[model samples]
Target: MFERYLAALEYPSQGGINIDDPKEFRNIVLWLEDQKIRHYTIEDRANLRKTGSATDWDPAYAKYKIDLGFPANLKSKTEELTWLFLYAIKLEYSDNADRYRSITAAQKIEQEKKSSAAPEIKSTNPFDKLDFTSPDFEEGSRKLAEKLGIAYHPDHLVSLRAASYVISTALNKEVLKEPIITGKPFPIDEGIGMGFENHQDLEKAARILRLLQIQNLRKLQTAINETIVAVQNITADPRTDTSLGKVGMK
Candidate 1:
């Protein structure tokens, strides 16, 4: 998908994509996402340019002589391309939902099994105390999320929120196992248990981070639910009545 985006830029449209109109030049090729998230079909995704984003970009796509399924009602190249972007992300969200469901279901099972044991009071989400009253946090978080291309519209916040918590909680689990020393210690079985420093600061840090993690994890679940609902609200296929791009780009 991104290769097509780069290819679109190669043809010079919309002043070409404004990478610096945003931030950091990270390679968008992310095969490193969670193993559960994957291509929805066997289709060559890089060649997934189903519609042109600009009349100029049409030539670039035409140079390759590829054809895309014209989106429903969008006639302009830009509109079709924009719709394509939404569709692509929708596909991504769909895949992520699957992964999220599986992970959560497994977690639920684990929790059920553990429920028979003594109850463990878990940390509250630190994110709950965030200063949402001030516009700074929401504004900054939204912009940063957009810059990082995580959550763009409010609808996408669900997946973004969930993913963030999953990361924090997973990290906190490791941090809670503290007395962490950089260097390898002698085997405990050999009576050489030494050099592990238990800092009060780490204990506090772990608590804060854990709280934040738990908070976000629940938010993430909410986000996922909202996203599923949002998807349900799309009643029309935008490309349904659309015509294809006009052939001449001169």
Candidate 2:
């Protein structure tokens, strides 16, 4: 019966259409237009729209949800699916749809249990270790964050001084601590109070940063030397007229 209804409506038999896929979902709009199913209330819209294009569903979806004693928002996908199952019944998709409803309910209950059992741990700082030298470097990070479903802030330092606290805390915990003598120390130790799980990891990261800095310095020095050498070569050329600057002699 469900299959028959979907066939009659020309709705896709396969399910799980993501709301974000605009190209694949334009078909739903066409189908609704063909049926002349316009001006649907939010409730009805939720029913027909199912997974995409809020405007495509009938407003009755809202009412269907209300009838089932669930909230209108249906925040979670499972919650929305439960409402969709009820909406399917309202559409006469199946005469004996209790089995489907039961399955959906079980799935919803399982989802709720899992969410309750293990709540996700939130990150304290989202943009940690995010550093950049150029604007392009930061832009690349922002693009990557979007693809990875992470929040990006145009916030991170490029200088080694900005990361000094991290390196100091990890490598020189003793220097950051109070003097063992217990007397007033001449220099107050500056520490961010963060500890490393493995000092070796911290050392490795610091080493890599140092190596990169050294490599960059070497490249800059080489470029500077090459420029100086080129200038010397030009000044020493015998074919050059000193005042006229490299005039070809007849």
How well is each residue in 111-132 modelled by candidate 1, as lDDT tens digits? 7679768966665999767776
Model 2 C-alpha lDDT per residue in residues 1-250, reported as the tens digit of each score: 3343344345654865553455344444434433433335454444454545455333544553455466656796445544443454355435445645566767867976886796667778865544556777666656655554444554633333334444565347776586655666532123332244368577555655666697899999999999999988877788666677654457
lDDT of 1: 0.48
RMSD to native for every prediction? 31.9, 20.8
* lDDT on C-alpha atoms for all candidate structures: 0.48, 0.53
Backbone clashes, candidate 2: 13
Q: How does each model score on TM-score? A: 0.19, 0.22
- How accurate locally is residue 24 in candidate 1, as Cα lDDT from 0 to 100? 14
